[model samples]
Target: MSDTPIEFKDFIRIIGRGQRAGRTLTMLEAEQAMSMIINGQATAEQKGAFLMLLRVREETPEELTGFSQAFRAHTPTSITELSVDLDMGCYAGKRRHLPWFLLAVMLLAKNGKRVFLHGTHEPDSKRLYLKEVLPQIGFEVAQTPDQAKVALDTLGFAYMDLKHINPQLDGIIQLREQFGLRSCANTLARMLNPSNAAHSLQGIFHRKIDVKHRETAALLNDANVLCFRGEGGEVEFNPLRDVTLHLSRSAQQSSEEVKATCETFITKPQELDAKQLISIWNGELDDTYANYGVVGTLSLMLVLVDKLDWNVAYQQAQQMWQGRDKTWPVALPKYNLAAETFDTTGKHYAH
Candidate 1:
């Protein structure tokens, strides 16, 4: 190797050159660039410019793939002891509605599905984020990967903030407050899949992000991924609107538009409370919107886990919700096959 060194300015120059001269970074270059940033080799101004320049245009799959590779290389923690079924990314907090998706995840966990979720702590944002919402229920936010593993072992679910997962990246993600626009940090965070789970569920708000995420997942060789335009960019399906679900399985991409099954949409509650999630799950609170949102989102997740058709999955989701163990985390039980499995289909998930 030559006794020469490269600087972060070179990366910024490649992307931030005048419109005609600028071009995207190659996969290798993207990886190196992100590695520098992650290692604190890049200046604050250089990092901001690089991110915003790429954000000005659409982020290419190669860039996302390389960024994700660099991120995973630095993140060595993994729940090797547990087989994680789903990796849920929750960077975009919900604004229009309560996070019904949390209930769906809780129901699946209660019925014995191991899920690992990572999200950002957007302190300045007006929306409600998972970091604050999770504790209101019975769940506690994991401060480290070991804590996350422990949660998965007992609760069948766990959530860690991006700050704990990678404080450097979280610091860059927080730049959104100053930039007034989201950077690629959000996208890179979504693709981490730190536990290397079998399936990944992602939600996006913009028009073509689902496609972008699918392509990036294929580049990363993720086994299965479900990307969709979700409610306020959380992985909760809007039951009142027809939604198109983008899918990537074994690097083959496809999409299907599912019709809206629920006819009514509820206005945002005056006060968003986590106790309501428990109430809805326990049948104490009869919320039409919450019911459809939970069941619909659960049906989508089931499609990822069981590979069932949407209709069949929706039906199964309803059944799962009805038979849920009302008391969870307090008297958590071992995986019960009879309770978790459906009698109609002989397909038993022995996991």
Candidate 2:
């Protein structure tokens, strides 16, 4: 409870003793270890060693659960009070495709389901992050939890950057650049649903991570969670590939994995300009491939949320798309450096 920093040696020794000598941290140990790091008790060397050792040994579901618990403890209660039907984790930047899920989340918000989508992208990321793309549509990524609540109250949805969620968590996540590879931070961050939403959707780049996410969600007793290998590990459903759904569905507060398949609807990913997301949403452009991408993703999320049956969800997704609001914010003459300026200086905002 003191501001004086404690060196991270005690926590590091638990997981980095020696080859075959070091042991995995128990759930309690992991949580305590994470607390120390988040509290700035860990030295830089110990932080890197702890993360690297965990990566080498591979992270267990229990470790991930503890990591997430530590994160949720830090989430501001104001953001948690806002009603979020779904908590979407979008840390994985999309490389080959634009984030169609952005439009999907917006449409779901329009349909009266409050959503809290949050994440951060690497500075050296080759992909376009939602931070950059959301701005084009006049949406400001919330810089703080209170601002996130405002975005939801006024815009019907919220996109929060990782820095706002927990600066310490964000600090560790940024270390990916120095580590030369991702660590457990990416996995645990994706599983963090700070608002305690009943339903969550995770998009993993690898199939193996799908199992870890579902397992961790079940341990957390989440009412519903769906993790699948998505296009570039983002929540967008790829029409070009068969999606293996890794799910955790709860009944009577108990959760279990329910695996399913989403058969590929198209032969390949569509070749379209990424900027067309604007026209696609406004109904000015109608490409069959893109249309299927949007509707299919919506259906999957709907089914994941237990809002509709499989067949009914697909049908309703199409209808929802047809009646979407087409009113557009007047295109800004130039993009601005600050996103928070959206609410005050913009000509218009989502009604």
RMSD to the true structure for each prediction, in A, is 8.8, 7.1
lDDT of 1 at 243: 88
Off by over 4 Å in 1: 1-5, 79-82, 331-351
- Model 1 error, position 175 (Å): 1.4
lDDT, candidates in the order shown: 0.80, 0.74
Q: lDDT score, residue 169, model 2?
A: 83
lDDT of 2 at 179: 84
Candidate 2 segments exceeding 4 Å error: 1-10, 251-274, 329-351
User: Given candidate 1, what's the lDDT at residue 303?
Assistant: 92
Q: What lDDT does model 1 reach?
A: 0.80
Q: Clashes per prediction?
A: 0, 0
Residues 56-140, model 1: lDDT tens digits: 8767999999998888886655543346899998988866567889889988887778999988866456676787667666577
